[model samples]
Target: MAEEEKRASPEPPLPSPPESSSQPEHPPPETSTPPATFDPSRMIGIIKRKALIKDLAAAYHVECLALCRELLELQKRKDEPFLDTKATEDLRKETLRSSSKRAKKKR
Candidate 1:
């Protein structure tokens, strides 16, 4: 009966896989060259294109600032009265002088 019970039991499960290490097994050498597919001229062209875009953006910013200043000045002028106090004073003096001259002529 013991021999028959042993034969009927299933085999034990396989052992669990080995625990993985946090670090890589082998690191690449530091002195390795870039891949042959990489082209230096292509990188240079990309850098020049970026510089051109930056320069154009800066020029656009300057032009926008200048236009904003011009618009602000125009708005300020529009807010001002048609005739300033100084000009009104001069006009009043001219009118008084003309009226005095007319009175003198009538007398």
Candidate 2:
């Protein structure tokens, strides 16, 4: 009966030790050199392509900024009314003269 009671109430499992914070849980990846198949010319080509793309993107950005400034200036001009009566009179006179010439031509 005593042996049966001891078997029934077994000792609790031992607690595991806490992990050390000083060491990382996973090992660092190993650094490796480029493969023997690597070609220096191919690497240079890729670098040149990247530089060309960067330059093109910069130029495109500058062009867009310039266009935006021009559009804004145009909008400002459009908002203002042209107050040149002399220019308007000249245009009107030219139109009349052209119409008279056209009428003469029709004759």
Candidate 3:
């Protein structure tokens, strides 16, 4: 009776394979990619932002140097004219970095 019942019950069917897509399996080559784009207005905004940061940094540096100079003067002898450090004049000659130089340093 058990053997007859097992033979009467049919097995479930197997699942079919997935269908293929229209696009290629692998991505297209870089050389075949679309041409690069340029936006003048967006670029100008970046340039303006960089300049603003530079100005702010310069102002901050000058303020810090002024505080250090005052501290030095108070600690030093009255006979000493001023701080002899070369960086003392850095306030007058602030470093101006170009975009090219900055990009190279990043790499």
Candidate 4:
């Protein structure tokens, strides 16, 4: 039985950079926010403000919906004549006839 010995291959080196940039190889340190301290008064004030904003928003929403409905109704009315065309025409003719009769009677 013949024993064969395997040669270990060498890994290629990384490409060299053209210029040394100002940037560091490692990323900049993360900015950390200050730890929050529990304040009952501040929390209560925030909750109250949030509730007030919600109430105001709801009121405005209702008002906006009302305005939208009014606008839609007005638009629909605009599409329809205030006095129907046939009725108005008949009324105008009747008025003219009545006026002519009154003028004849005055004569």
Name the best candidate (by TM-score): 4
Model 1, 1-107: lDDT tens per residue?
99999999999999998868976789767777766797899999999999999999999999999999999999879766654766888999999998887555554
- Report how far residue 21 has shifted in candidate 1, in Å: 39
lDDT of 4 by residue, 1-107 (tens): 12333334455788897766887888877779667899899999999999999999999999999999999999879867855786889999999998887555554
The lDDT-based order of candidates, best leading, equals: 1, 2, 4, 3
Model 1 — which ten-residue stretch has the worst lDDT?
A: 98-107
Greater-TM-score candidate between 2 and 4? 4
Best by lDDT: 1
Per-residue lDDT tens digits of candidate 2, residues 5-98? 9899968999999889999989997679655697899999999999999999999999999999999999878765554665788899999998
Displacement of residue 77 (Cα, Å) in model 4 is: 0.7
TM-scores, in order shown?
0.42, 0.39, 0.38, 0.44
Candidate 3 residue pairs that clash: none
Report the alpha-carbon TM-score of model 2 versus the true structure: 0.39
- Least accurate stretch of 10 residues (summed lDDT) in model 3? 92-101
| Tens digit per residue, CA lDDT, model 3, 2-87 | 99999999888888877679768897678865786897998999999999999999999999999999988777765354554445
| C-alpha lDDT score of every prediction, in listed order | 0.88, 0.87, 0.77, 0.84
Q: Is candidate 1 or candidate 2 better by TM-score?
A: 1
Score candidate 4 by TM-score against the native.
0.44
RMSD of each: 15.2, 17.1, 25.5, 12.1
Which segments of candidate 1 are over 4 A away from where they belong? Answer: 1-36, 82-107
